[model samples]
Target: MEQAKDLLAKGVLKPGDYAYHEGLSDWTPLLEVIVANSEPEASPTPSVGPSLSTAPTPKAKSNATLVVGIVVGLMVLGGLAAAGGWYFFLRDEPMELVKTTPPLKVNVPPNKEVEKILAREIGIWKITGHRLPVIDPETGGPGKAEDIRDTIETRWKEKGKSTVSTFSPVINGKKVSFVGYKEYDAKDGVFIWRVKGEGLPETVSKERYDPVTKTFHGEVNYQNNTRELSTFRRINKDRVHFKSKLFDADNKLLGTSEMLFTRLEKKEPDQPPMTAGSLTAKEAAEVMAWVIGKWETKGKGMPVGGEPQAIEITMEARWKEEGKSVEFKYTMEEGGKTVSYFGHQQYDEARGIFINRSKWGDNPETTSHERYDPATRTSRAQSMPVSPAVGSKTTTVTKRIGQDKTQQTLEVYQDGQLVYSHEIVSTRIGRYVEPARPEPAPHAPQNGLVAYYPFNGNARDEAGHGHDGTVIGARLTADRHDRADSAYQFKLGDHIRIKGLMGKPKNVTLAAWVKLNGQQGRSGADIISIGTSVNIRVDSKSGTGGSSRTGRGSWLGTNAKVNYTDTGWHQIVFTFNDNTDRQVVYVDGTSMAASRNQIPIFYEGRETDTVVGINGRERNAGFETQGVIDDIRVYDRTLSAAEVKALFHSE
Candidate 1:
């Protein structure tokens, strides 16, 4: 064991350096060892002890440990060498070898040729794939297979090929595979071409024959960790039909399908024409002319005749005469009452034709007609009653001439026999005449007039004037004046007397403002006069015959009594109804007296001219008005009590 340890230390017999030979039960190193022997000397010396191979001495513990350490160190060195060898020679070596084959060329027409073919084909033959040959068909060569595939795919897109596939088969006792296809495309003008490939399924696999393009247009899985390949092809011209297949790792067929694609058509467009009747001016004018004029007819008791049950018709139509035609219409009244009646007269074309229509009370057929008669200056026609059973009559004539024209006479006939005749002149000579002198235009009362005179500015005296009176310079002081009388006046010497005037003096209203000064005694002292013919007086001195009576009197001494005061300004209004023998007087807005005993008698004789400022007794007679008096207004018609009050406060 000691010798063994020494040998081991000298790198001679480590446990792993040798293996025990099975047959020999001895250890031997597996590696061949070369030994160099110098020429052996001729003698050999024999050892002296028992001749047994000297039993190896037991090794010391330290030597054995040293030997084991040496052996462990050699083992570690051997393992490191093996690891280094594996890393340098085998770790990064490629797992797969790929042969990049050049793309196969398809014997198809050029794009220009295909385009022409597409135009003629119209509905079939779609080109699927094409490419320039990268490798000679006779000699396989290396090329960029992906670039070739991309070129082929681009051509297929352009040509629209279909049904390209790869196929595998046994040929001539050898397993061979190839790509086969067919292309139905417009480039082939509706025909399909079959294509086949050589030597592809063994190193690479293809699916099926598409009969149109020489390409593998489907998925192929390889067994030895090869990349899968897939192809696509289009078959139809107007529509597209494609074929695809998948292969397994053992190059076995997995699946297949025929897919179809179709194209859409277009659609055609929509399109309506361009020209219409209204009233002419002449026709409208003709219709409008038949509605204008005034017409009149008289029956019993009408305005023209004095019968209680008279019927009268009057029509006023204006501005409806047109060229050669005239129209007129009339309304009817019977017995001072209205009854239904209508009449229309139309003349056409200078009296060439005349139509007369008359309707009365549900009798529409009581119409007549007339034609122009140039020789007689008339229009003559026939007439019939509303009942058709009644006989028709002849010679209804409307005279066209003025003044002394042919008259119209009515003769009723029954059964062609005259039953009654009524002779009436429809148009008379001088039927419408102008008067020698034109009548004067009627006068309307100026009811809204304001008082014009009287210088005093007191409003109480101006009450009945409908407005405030103006003040002016006068004989008396401006602040001390008498009320003006609206009553017409005549003067006895210089004494003003109230009297009647022209133009219907029967109905009269006398309004004034007055203020009495003293109860005086006098005769014929006039407050107002009608030209010395009639007078309105106040006798404040005595009640009756002594002129102390406050009363309103006429020229004939017919008087109506009233009350008066010597206080301030007061409005006095007097009204007379000669037709009814009644008289009324108002003070302020209240009625002082309404009397029938002192009736107002219309004065027949004319009076002297009117006077103002004072009566004819200019020395002692004016108004005994000691205070201011102002406006007055007179009317030719009797005024009611309400009207007098309204006028007082109207301002």
Candidate 2:
């Protein structure tokens, strides 16, 4: 109690002071502190020192203690202040206290889900027709179908010499003549013929009837050749059908076309066909199996004349195939280097036909069919017609039978005349042997540019100045090192700058041999500017605003430097990278220190226009350094440091 009273007397308890509570650390009101203090004082007062009367005045002791208490309290408050500042202001707050919501979930649909699958069904048919019907004169109607059979046979005999056979028939009260012709030569000396009569319109005009014409049109075989000439009759104005027989020159029956046609209804425009599936690994293996094994080809197209020549063509069908279909590639040595051509056959089991497409050299579309022939142990195929523009020729392709079955021969015919023949011998090896990769050409410098000068030694400037005249005399040195500029100078009045070459340029390099003798000790002049009229300056003094000098050493000249020297021959190369932040200039392959300036200073006097030996004013004012110039070139790419050095020292 005494100690408590002494502490209280010293004014240590502030208004917010309270007894320490176990649960809550917050300061209680001073009233709570006073009540807690009073209770402690009433509880105990031990009667202690009687000899303490002689002790120094208790006031001095109390004052001294009060001072000490105040000091201690101040120190504690200062420490609390420092700690509070650090926790709330200086230090980072707890990350958990920060109110941050989780990232919003983005729902990306699957690629397949986003794509709309469209379904289509394609119907194909092989039509064959071999019969005809009779006609009634009185009713103008078709007679018994059986009776016309004899008439058709008789007409064929009468027109056997000519290519066409005709029959007169009545249909729907109209007299119509059905005409048919044979348009192809068969191996048996027979040609396929078609007959159209009554109700049938003449689809094959005389212009398209001859064998030469049919061949020119790209018909595959005698059967198709005849069918192409057959005409269809419009039945009920909604349906059309045609029937014809294919016969050889000897009038022997070969094939027929009994085609049925229906008018296509107007529908939505067709979308590009999508591939349904690709060849499986097993199917690929099977396809390659037939191609595996060494084979040789004979016949005219083979290397040796009509003799089996040793040739090797390896077939590789793998991911390298284009699009969705697998490709059968045949690579073999022709002449000296290995040349490769591919026969891409897509087998649509559902369609029952293997569509074989091939390309050789630069030939146009040549196609064929692959039909399995068990007897020959090969596929019988025929080449599609070649364009008449391709020398009025037709090429026939035959895949021969053999254990390897990889050899094929091609025969080209022009107007029924045999032309050239080629043979392709392919083999299938068990192991996949990758084709040899050709050695790569030396890598060109990334910043290098090359210019080819095609002009003769006689080129003139726009101002009608020739090589020996003022234009060339004013710009070139006495010794013409750069051959391109030695004999030519583009004059001012020429008004046209024809690039010696023809092509679009992505990056450009400009080079020239210059000898500037015009006006000395000036700055801010220009020799050539590419982009805009006011984009480039040759020489000029710094701080010269508008109204700068036009020639060498004008305001355009920076740092009092004469990029256009009036002395000897010097090669100047300027490279511009349209893609970068800087342009470079090389004076004999050595880079010059220059300020970063925008390309093509555009202005009447600012050196923006393409000028040679002078500024835009057409004034040659500088020191007039005279020298012969030659060999000016330009490149489409920037030159590397090494390339610039090479150009400078190039003889």
Candidate 3:
């Protein structure tokens, strides 16, 4: 009975639970037994008569003292035995040492319910739906989308005796990542999640699971006292639905989001890879970068009943799967009725062509094969009929003009004859900006160097000459050696200008590392120029490299293309020797052009500033450099062949 009471007080046993002891017929309610009389005290013995004599005999007194000493000695031995039993046996078990003992902590195994919940969530999920756009009540227009999309991967891990699940959502091309951990609190019947990541505030949230509905409801607290009410429901083994509503500090509803997650199926080991044409998915997607923007077109449709109908069309394109594919949406309005179409485009390696699949509401899908030319910015596509029995084949020729405009021509053919044709001129929604990527910075010796521009973030001269240049519309990029911000990339209208030397040198050599862009043509682009007299430029007709003067025409022509198609970095050197009457142009350490009868370069006293990327005298688009330039150096004396080779291999 005492032991039962002690266990009940410490909460090791519940009061209402049944318990049994040696004397009980069967287990009985602990409550009923605890309240029952604890082994009733022995009935009091009958009262004995008082002794009459005040003193006893000596023999009788000695006998009473011996009896008292024996009882004391036995009690001491029993106490020592009880202490030893507690130290060896009962120390590891829960015990109620006193009436104020705290409740014992139970170390029960995790329940099956928590494991089942975690199993349903631990898998790779891809977002199938995006947050809906908020509509403007006044204009009835929708706002832009938020939190575009990404893949989410989660797994459950063991931390000591507890379960911890990890969550990370990854977005392609972005450096930021989110980390989260979840643990179950059985006492509170809730699961808690703590999340933190780059550029995000730490959050701790609690959620309750509903087994019947397979759903979870939670409240997430953010910074500034703001909170969000969120719910997640498992629709099936491979799908989950999530919704959240954000609330301000004052409890005002701000916004809401909804998303659908679909588990990614595992790939089969024997499945072939996805690829197209001569390019990989990423390369194929990048070839469409010029068209990945909003565009609008207005044209007269094919003649209908002796009159052409007015047609308006708009299109938007975006990259998907990290540039493996391109997705496009377009809206067309004809005869006052609007129709929309969505399309996906990718390269088909087997077909050696680009393929486009398009669909419209309730309409049969159409597929087209296109042959695209990057150099010409043109594509010829033959689109099949939505139904083989009803429509003729349509051919489309699209030509991109400059950066912001495109022209498309469509023709329908039937019975081997052209039936109808339409033309469209689409203008981009905004001004187009060309992308220029940086290259690795190369190294070179400083011997006899007059001016050197490493271009490391700034255009400061590093050759002990105060000839720093002013940069315009240029971006710092990695160099030839993959050094970040060690070089500069130049696009259209980008250049660097430095103060010209006080006087012309008797013999001079100009060298620079250049990486030509894909858009460079066979003509009219200047690399470096000093005034109008001396310049290293792409010749007017051949795209070959050369140095030229105003009256002398070209002093030296390399007759080698500027390496636009090759897409590799190359070193260009132009040396003029006054004493030998020789002018030599070298590309990648080998002399491509040399002149023994050339006159010395002349510099007028009023020469303009030294210019890089374009002509010093002419600042037009015709002479704009369409590439990256790095590690430019000017020397007062010509360099030998060995020194030129060293500069080329320095990287």
Candidate 4:
């Protein structure tokens, strides 16, 4: 007590400090105890100590109650003080507290979590292997399916914080037909994948990733009609394995597919493929782009049960599966009927070969495998009958001769012996351009010239033979030389009637300068024709020139290989020598078609009016030229090959 009084007097002991002893019920501040025990004592220096009175301070009747109240009040006060003190202390030494305190676990932001997973997917991935469940007919159970190739590209978007994925499947190797996005919902604490594709319903899947196993699991809902469970396991930085199991509405397992993805190294666009195994569908499609067009094919071969004969085949090819494959339609006129066949060709990346499939009516399908040589722009193909009972086989070699031409040689074998062969030439029905050539000087051969219509702003016969023509429904247009109103543009129902022209002559030559608009009607567009006597027209099917007796079908006409019905200016000439009963057709100074010992036109000697731009008998029908005509000429005698060349050069 003496030591405590001395310490209190020197201000070393604070009032809030508690004092305890064995007799005390609980800790009590010394200030309250001292004030309770002491009386007021007068001193010379009253300010140096707390005020004291000789009489004792009034106390509660229940000392125990007072002690309890004081203790509770002190505890409450201490808690507030301690809290305030810790706040300041933490502000001063935050790292020290963190090092000593137990840490709390919290979730990362949803967007951040999404970024963590997709970052591994940002690159090109190829389907190196695939397996599908197939039904076995013999056992009525599941069997293994073959593998195929596909490509997928995942890239970063939205400032590199988000990712979007795109896929180019084998069905359409040239286009990105499938697109997908990955998103996260913070409120739901889930990841979602929304996928859409061409001809496919949009699919949504909720997914979760397990970092422990480096795997992602998803439950997919396809427009509420089907469901699938998918798993993707990341084997390493460059490989992933994916499996999907499809279920029916009743929760029955229907099928399962598995794929192995491997990262692909980027290559330059112009670089050739390193190997056949690494060829992409897009690259293969590019190599075949030149084949998309209409083509006219001509060849001669002996049929299996028929005599040898000339064959004319018209083929049209176009893009299918968004350019992954080329689809073809072929038509051949035989025995007054058209025989049609449908086929398609596509690249098989797995086998490094081209597959061609064809079907003819109800016949079984025929499949062929081809190997391509990029350096020579050629493909070699071999085909065998599906049934081993048939020993017939075919081998073909197709080569690209030019931008507008190709040549194919086909050989057939039966029982290891050569049975027949054919060489077919295909010509594209258009020109690169009509090269501008200087017109020959106005010195055409005049020995056999009988009538001429220069069409130089008028339809009068320039030869001055009084074979003037009257234009109807035809309009003047620019000539091939770009001279205004020097040519005539013909449309449906448009024609020019000429008087005194369709007489029977011993030998005759018909020539004209033409510019075709495009393809014309089925019966072909007439450049000049008479009533069932003679005609020169564009063969609509082949886009070439044809000459024959008027009203004769295409089978009876003499068609040329030169496609005069191209999108450019051309000069066409037809010459006939009645003595030899030989006829020749020329386009742009080259002989394209010839015939001998055929029935001559106008043999019955009919003198019908000559009509230009449409057949005289089918006026106003769909057989109009659909083209422009200029510089028409008629000769009473056969024009020599040189004479025809001179006429073409005369422009």
How would you encode candidate 1's per-residue C-alpha lDDT over 155-236 as one tens digit per residue?
1212233322222222223322222223434443232323222211112122322335522233222232222223323344
What is the overall TM-score of model 1 with all chains considered together?
A: 0.23
Model 4 misplaced stretches (Cα beyond 4 Å): 1-441, 550-556, 603-607, 619-622
Candidate 2 local lDDT, 497-523, one digit each (tens): 332221234455656654444443244
Candidate 2 stretches greater than 4 Å from native: 1-319, 322-365, 369-378, 389-426, 435-440, 445-651
Question: Against the true structure, what is every candidate's RMSD?
Answer: 56.0, 45.0, 31.4, 36.2
Tens-digit per-residue lDDT, 39-125, candidate 3:
322332211111111122222223222222111111110101101110110112222221111112323226775766665555455
lDDT of 2: 0.33
> lDDT of all the models against the reference?
0.33, 0.33, 0.55, 0.57
For each predicted model, how many residue pairs clash, with residues at least 3 apart or on different chains? Answer: 69, 91, 12, 5
Candidate 3 has its poorest 10 consecutive residues by lDDT at: 77-86
Q: How accurate is candidate 4 locally (lDDT)?
A: 0.57
Candidate order, lDDT descending: 4, 3, 2, 1
Tell me the spans in candidate 3 whose CA falls farther than 4 Å from its real position: 1-445, 550-558, 561-566
Q: Is 2 or 3 the stronger prediction by TM-score?
A: 3
Error of 3 at 65 (Å): 99
